[model samples]
Target: MTTKTGDQESPLASQVDPQTSVSRVPPPETPAAVQTRFRVIAAFWAVIIFLGFPIWWKTTSIYRASLPLEEMVHWADGKTCRPVFPLEIHLSTPSLPYIEAQHLLRTTQHTLDDLNEFAAHHLRLKLANDTTGDHTGQDSSEHVNYAARETPDTALTVRLLPQEGLASPRSELHAATTQLDVFYPPSQIPVSSSSNSPLSTFIAAELQQLYGEEKATIAHILSGDTARLASTSPQLAEDISRRLRRSMKYAETYHLSFSLFTPGAEPSSWDIEAAVNEYVSPLLQALSPISNFTVDTQVQLYANFAPTAPKPEYDESEAVWTLKKEGLSAFVNAAEWPLNPSIGTGPTINFILYVPDPSQSPLVVKENSASSWIVPQWGGVFLLNPPLSNDEQGSRSNPAHLSLGSLGPAFMTFSHQLLTLLGTPSTPASLPLRLQTSIRIRAATLLLSASSTMGSLARLTESLPSIPIPATVATSVSTTLSHLTATCSHLREGRFGAALASARVAETEAERSFFEKSMVGQVYFPDEHKVAVYLPLLGPIGVPLVVGLLRELKRIAAKRKAKAS
Candidate 1:
């Protein structure tokens, strides 16, 4: 019903107007919609913070061992200790009066100082009053293995003998003992007043010459610069390089593998144990102070070269069966040689006695016809061509039997080659002296190598923080640090064998820690993978939630402004 007129009153203002119908549809359930939208967002954020964040943190963090990083850096920086060689010299003069002996010792020390070029390694002379003190000192030094030098720790004992030599002083180096027999011409004895003399210089030069090779080697190692030898000579530098290249990496125990390889089946059997005892064992025994050698012998027959390897060609110029110098390295036929290292901790040094077939006897280097060459940190090979004939069993000839006696030359050559490979010096006629020098060289080498390794480990950790540092790696680092300390201490004590053993352990541990497989596998997720996994889920779920939140925020801001107005 339409009412009278100033305005038409619809019976229902309560009835929906067309404009109101368009405008008010349950107010679009705004508050409930907002609360639902908020709950959904809060749930998503909770999952992201609690689930995603922890997973990312746990996955990315490095398992850093409680390493003494400060101490390690300190050691690497050379702040830990300055290695000094305070060598003790026990001067025992039973014949000379005590006062005279002391005087002689003082003069000799002055002479030694005058000759010494290296300040780190020096001789401290202490006059021994009694024979028992010398023995006791030696035993205690060996047992306790103290780093500090005390009495009876002399490297060499000079026995002053008045001999019938006419012209000058003479020195005899004892092969067994660390004794130098210094015979002064009776006319040349130092009277109470002489401050300088020719005899002293002569003795100094002789001793210097004896230790010269070792000094150069140690210098080469310490400086890490062979170019220092350019001032000496290019030839000397080349010689130094050759020596270093041939020398094996230092180890506590060296596996001395004696392999008898033949192109043909004959000469398969050798009296190896006896040959080793006679030809090799003595030298190894002489080497005992430097390293422990475990010897194992095997005979590999029918060992042939790879097909791609250059075949041995007869050299008319040399008039012998020759292997080209280029292929000489491959001549060993390593794939076929059964020269596996003896089972042990130290590296294996192989000594191969390759007996060529009767047809190929007298094999020589195509370039030099040299019978021997080194395999560089491995071993040496000597082509043995025993007088050939087709007469005996297991032999193409009578020499095939090759009694333990026959191996004498081959093994002797091998022993020499082995010494070279083991970093034994050629100078200083005394074998014991050479071995001792070898010990010092090895200790220096290991020390440097281990230090460099630590530096590498530190750098690696710094570069890759995401990698997992397992407890094993921590244990390994600790082991390395401890062994390195032990090695340094042993070197100071002049217990070279113990030092080498410790160094070997340190190297192994350092390698193990550095190459931890688990640590290497982090930071490797591909970009393609991240895109493949997250994009699909995030894109679909993110749009509506973002729009709803924006709308609710705008509506709340407008209501607050209107209420304030």
Candidate 2:
């Protein structure tokens, strides 16, 4: 009953009882087995460090290219290009003797030099060939080519005509050509002995007056303040500021889209081809030397006003539908109207010829009671209220097709708006002269714009250290710098047209570099996303490797202690 006193058991029973039998212990590890485990662990770490880690790094890393950051910043700071405009004015003395003409030129040059305070924009008077003839009364075609060939950058030509009827010198600027006519009384002519004469003084005064605004504008743009560079009247400064604010940015090309918009079904077609040919083609041709233009036209029906737009109301005093002057900005139903910009590298100018519904007939701006107005850099808007159709119901509807004659006035306004939007100066009655002035203005504007853009890009890179800059951005920056340098050189050499072309390239490249899609896309990857993607794989693999490394280290330390004992 006592089970033979627990210790007194048979050999077989003792063997069956696991506690009394010898315990099964694992054998000590062989040197080869320990070496094999060590090799396996080392292999795992080697694969991680040399292969897996490198692959992950290559896949996840961003690509950045070297850039000339200092150079770009310098260009933006206006430290690189100090723009100088040495305008060359040709003096044509058809009536004066050679020595007398030279004497007048000397005296006038001295007077002009004395009057000019802006050294960068001073006029350089040069004598024109006598054979070019008096271009004052003649057509521009008669002398433009000859003058262009002889003197490449002649801003204006002064034709001296001695008249018996004139008591004092009277100057006239041609409306089409770059010629200025000075009809002088014979007595006002400068004698060889006289250092200064009335004619020279008059010419100097007229020249100053003609270029006064231009000088102010250039100075304002260069110095960023007219008050700092020269003494500019408040009125002139205000006008310049207004014009600059209203003008469009400089571009290599401009798309002119003339659209006929109507809320109703009528006025579905227009003689836009003929209208453009007659009114806009010549101006575009004249502007071809500075920039290219693409002309297109369309007629859109059922184009209603936006929901938030101000509706025209009947004016009691004028007995017409009138829109408030303040609300004119929202007159164009941009949401409903198909005023998409023309597809091109340059900007698209939209000229909307809106035909109001019969209910809002004779719609005009309330304050001025005008039918047309310029929308700053956008375009122009004109309200055309066509006469009602003669029907049994007497429905008020616009004509299906607008004739060229009917479209003339609207197109004329559009042309003038186009000129203003292109940053053409209002002064100087000559069209060619205005175009030249526009060229200079555009050049100056583009140069400053590109410089500013470069500065902005440099600052952007410095501010956002995590944003990856691509090789294309570096390439674009280089191209911009090179073209900007070329533009400055061209301006210095009086090649304004060439300068504009180069500046266009520089601006395009600069904008492209600054707005690169890839660079922008790289900046938005969040830290949460990175952790979610990497933690699962790294956690499992790292724990085992670290534990194995620690166990091996502990074993080696114990072995060294045993050896030391």
Candidate 3:
């Protein structure tokens, strides 16, 4: 075994290798190339920061309009307006002289002031001229007739007459008009020396009695505390609460629908036009100043009761068919009844005149044995058991055409129900006076409702930071505030009609603001969802850019270190 020298082994190794036996090492990159690469990276980052990021942000951001948040909150807090009622009562004393009448007016006002406890609602008395064609107190009847006409801003008229037959002072309130007839003995008239007299005391007490329920109701509505109102009786408070609950919400208009429903087919035609024209048209006209009403009537046959409704049973003792009181609630078959609300902005009031089948004639509510009942806010129902037609087989059948006379009682009941549903006070025995009361009640209700809506909107905005309020909501808020202010001014100036109109607008605007569609709609995107959606695109593009940036920064740091060394 001979070991070869290292030089000779290297020659053999070189011959064994391929033709290219030499390995070459490349030179370092030039500064121009390094600067070009760094510039490319910098340009990419600049585009991302200036253009790409802004586009993404603009596309994803929500659009929120500017709002007067502070002003809205203030209005909601009831800091914007306070409501006050100043009722003007006109005194027409045709019997007394001018000086005596003025003295009586002053004394009565003083008496009323002393008796009244609630300051917000107080009465003001003004004397109406008793000049009815010459002699005073000579034509008392003519004077009363003249005074009954529509007096401007007048709530009530007092007609004083001196009667020789009267033992004591007597007061009679007119059921039709806002007039009070006071018949007194001539001796009871107030003299100049007497500050307090029997006549003044009587008038004061009468006025107090007239407005007692109204004052309590106003107080309850304003404060919502019945216990604090001293004049409110338990029964009165319960009545007020029931009326409020049963009454329909205040509206600018109401659609009154008179429908005749029957289980059989005989009573298909009715004198509805005549009935509405005679009985309902007058009432609707009377209520026109408060709310506009559209009258429509219909007749529906083959209308059956719901399955859940209790079946009417024959009362052998009373000889009539009767339905249980609790079952009256289900008398109207809501599922099958064609009682859809009228096409309008306001609500529809349905007056259902149900005529039971001849077999179930004389149907009445079991508890009260009554033929009429109110559905509380919805409308009213009247069971009319028309006399059956006589036939050879003695089979019972309703008449084909109902007369105007037959519909009188039903329509009257409907009118009363309409009044109740409109939140009219039960007292005062005057339609005009009751309407005025309704105006005040409706105004108060609208004001409070708007205030509550404003507060709710404010709280909602505070609670939900993500919801984007549209400019419409701000516009609605501003309108509501302006109308509320106008309403307060109208009430103060005794323009109740205008006040009601303003309150209606305020309520409508507040509701619009609170229930704004855009403000209510909010699409919530969770952080996890955001990450899931963005990660796929960002992950692919971000890693390379970040790594390149970090590597470039490290290289620059190393260069600085070398230069320092």
TM-score for every candidate vs. truth? 0.81, 0.84, 0.87
Give the per-residue lDDT digits (tens) of candidate 3, residues 1-565.
Answer: 3446855555456456464556555688899989998999999899999999999999976677666667677766777777888888888887789999989999999999999888878898888874344546647777666545323366788888889977889999887888998988999889987798898999999999898888888888888867776667899899988888999987888988889999989799999988888888898888887889987888899999999999999999999999999888888999998997655778998999999999899899888899998888889999998778976788878999899888888989888999998989998787888888888888888988887888888888877777788888888988998898888887776767778888999999999988887766573653567789999979989999999999899999999999999
Query: Judged by TM-score relative to the true structure, which candidate is superior, 1 or 2?
Result: 2
lDDT of 3 at 90: 81
Distance (Å) between predicted and true CA of 173, model 1? 0.6
lDDT of 2 at 95: 79
**CA lDDT, every prediction?**
0.73, 0.86, 0.85
Deviation in Å, model 2, residue 209 alpha carbon: 1.8
How many clashes in each structure? 1, 0, 0
Candidate 1's TM-score:
0.81
Q: Which stretches of candidate 3 lie over 4 Å from their true place?
A: 1-29, 129-152, 523-532, 550-565
For 1-565, candidate 2 gives per-residue lDDT tens digits of: 2345556865556448665466876899999999999999989989989999899899878787888889999998988998988788889997788989999999999999999889889887878864544668767786776566444477888889999977789999889888899989999888989999999999989988888878888888888778754557888888888988998877778889889988888878888999999999999999887789998788889898888988888988888999998998888877778788556778988899998887788788888889999899888898887776765687666678788888999999999999988888888777888898888887888899899999999998888767889999999999999999999998887878878889889988999999999888767875577899888968987899999999998999999999999
Error of 3 at 222 (Å): 1.5
Clashing pairs in 3: none
Ranking by lDDT: 2, 3, 1
Among these predictions, the greatest TM-score belongs to 3
